[model samples]
Target: MSAERYEYVPHHLLRRRVRDIASGVEGELMAVINENVSDSPLREHWVELAHIRGASGREFTTAAANVVPA
Candidate 1:
């Protein structure tokens, strides 16, 4: 697709905020895909990253479009 403008990635959970250790910039965040049942330290902090589009307040997945995954 055109680049998931906004998407929710499931995170396991974390003891403290990991904004410093993970990759990316100071204000930026990253997500890791976990195929196995194991968990990552990052997962413990972020339950889901609410990716926000521009200032339009219009998310990529609307109420109807969110019925199923693309």
Candidate 2:
């Protein structure tokens, strides 16, 4: 059997304006969460954003691939 491999992509998204392609919501990137699996070579990139909507300044997390510079 062959092992699966994935390429590591670097992202500098902190404090930058980004938009979620799936949700159509734009906000300032607040944090980046990296999740490492012990059994796999894959690393998941999770991003947190602020000021999604309204005056409350809501925040949410989603896959990094869903976000793009706005």
Candidate 3:
């Protein structure tokens, strides 16, 4: 089976208020972590947030695709 393909378009979400679509939670976007694959053309984006409502921790990471401006 072939792997799923993704475009490497990075979003500028730093210090912006964003909401997670899947969880419907909002928070201030703290960081964007990019992982470049050596054998693939796509890069993975992970986002970290601070001051998240209804969350147990102070920060968490989620896929960049799951977040949008709040």
Which one wins by TM-score: 1 or 2?
2
Indicate whether candidate 1 or candidate 2 has the larger lDDT: 2
lDDT of 3 by residue, 3-70 (tens): 53333433576677788787888787766555333454454443332333334437765677787889
TM-score of 1: 0.20
Best by TM-score, which number? 2
Compute the lDDT of residue 18 as modeled in candidate 1.
27
1-70 per-residue lDDT for model 2 (tens digits): 1242333344686677888787877887766554443453354433332322312488876677687887
Off by over 4 Å in 1: 1-4, 14-19, 22-70
Q: After TM-score superposition, what is the CA distance of residue 66 in candidate 2 from its true location, in Å?
A: 0.9
**Candidate 3 at 39: error in angstroms?**
15
Q: Mind giving the per-residue lDDT tens digits that candidate 1 earns over 1-70?
A: 2222334445432222223222221221223222222255333322233222223433321122112111
lDDT of 2: 0.58
Worst 10 residues of 3 by lDDT: 46-55
- Taking all chains together, each candidate's TM-score versus the true structure is 0.20, 0.54, 0.52
Question: Each candidate: how many clashes?
Answer: 5, 0, 0
